[model samples]
Target: MAKNMYSLMLMDEVVSQIDRIAAQSSTNRSNLINEILADYVSFVTPQKHIQNIFESISAIIDDVAALTVQDMAASSVICIKSALSYKYRPTIRYSVELFSDNKSLGELRVTFRTQSAELLMEITHFLSLWMQLEQHYISKFDSKDSISYAIEQGRFKRTLMYPKNSSLHNSDEVSKAIADYIQMFDEILKGYLNGEYNTDADVEYRYLNYLKSGLTVI
Candidate 1:
C-alpha cells in the first residue's frame, strides 16, 4: 500500500476518540483511521489481511493441547507458547509476524530461555539440524534463495515464503500451513531432546514423512 499525506478536516471529538482507540489497539492514529475507512469502503488493507490470517491460525490451533495462543494487541503479530518435555519444562515461544509488503510472507521466530548450558547447546544443535533439513527438502519445490534463516544463542528465525501453489488465494490455507509447520517443529524438537529420536536419521525420517503428507509448505 502506498501511503500519501492528505489533510482532512474532522471534529475534535471524533479525532480524540480515534486516538483513544488507536492507542488501545497499539497502532497510530493515521493507521487506525485508514483501517476504519478501508473497512467502510469494503477494501481489504494489508493489516486486515494479516489479521484474518492470524485469526484463522488461532482457530486452527485452539484445539491443540500442546500449544497456547496468547492475545496480542498488534494486528500483524501472533505469539504462541509451548513447553518442552525436558528438565524444568522450559517454555518455547513462537512469534509469527506477517509483512505488509509483497516481498515476502512473514517471519517465524522460535525463542527459548534457559539457565542450563547443556540444554541451550542441545537446542542450538537441534535448530541447526532443522534448518539443514528444511533446506534439503524444501528446495526441491521452492527456490532455496526464497527462504532465509538465522540462529542466535537461544532463538531461531526463519522467513516464511509464499507457497508454490498459486491456487491457494485464501488466508485459511496459509494459516493452516503455518500452524502445522509450527506444531511439527515443536514436536520434533521435543522428541529429539527427550531421546525419543535416537539419531539424526530418525528426525529426517519424520520431517520427510511430513513433506510427503501432501500439506502446503511455506
Candidate 2:
C-alpha cells in the first residue's frame, strides 16, 4: 500500500452526528471519520484519476518533453496505477465469475467483467502501442451500462472533479464506456485532421493545434 497523504476536514455538524452514532457503534468518531474518508477516496478516485493524471502529464510535458511513462513521479505513478484495478490484474486485480445460470458456479477468476472481453481486448491492443497506461479514461453514452468504453491515451486533463460524481462513483462499466467515448473523440479529431471528415467548429476534442495547426501569435 502506498502512503495516503491529504488534509482532513470534517464539518462540525457531521462530526457531532458521528459522535452520537460512534457511541452506539462502540467506535470513536475519529475512526469512523477516517473510515468514511477512506471509503470516499476509494469510491471516487478510480474514475476521475485520469483527469488528475492528465493534468500532471500536461504540466510536465512542456518541461519534460522526453518524459516516458516511467519518468512520472512516484505519487503520480501511484495515483495513476491505482486507477487500473482491472486491466492490471494479477499485480493489481479485480475478480470475476461466469455462470451457465445465475445460481450455478461455472467459472471464476481474478478479472473484470467478462461481458466486456471484446471491448477490453480492443483497448488492450490500442494501449500496447501507446505509452504504458497509468490510468484508463472513460466516457459514457445514453445507454449507460450497455454502451460503454475505455481508452488508453497519452494525456489526461481536469483535476478537481476527480473525487465527485453520482452515477459513475461506483460503476466500473461506466468508467470503461467513458474511456471509449474519449477515444472516439480522439478518433474523430484525427479523422477531421486527415480530411476524412469535414472540419467543424464543434470538434469533439477541439485541439486547435491538431485541428488546424495554424493558431498562434508572434
Best by lDDT: 1
**Every candidate's lDDT:** 0.87, 0.34
TM-score of 1: 0.94
Indicate the worst ten consecutive residues by lDDT in candidate 1. 137-146
Clashing pairs for model 1 are none
> Compared with the true structure, what per-residue lDDT tens digits does model 1 show for residues 30-52?
99999999999999988898899
At residue 143, candidate 2 shows an lDDT of 18
Candidate with best TM-score: 1
Cα lDDT tens digits for candidate 2, 1-218: 23355676869898799999877755676655665666787743331343343444334433422222233232222111112223333121211111222122111111222244553564344333221211221222111122112332322222111222333322343233333323333454335434554434333234333324431100
Candidate 2 C-alpha error for residue 119, in Å: 32
TM-score of 2: 0.23
Q: Candidate 1, which segments miss by more than 4 Å at Cα?
A: 165-169
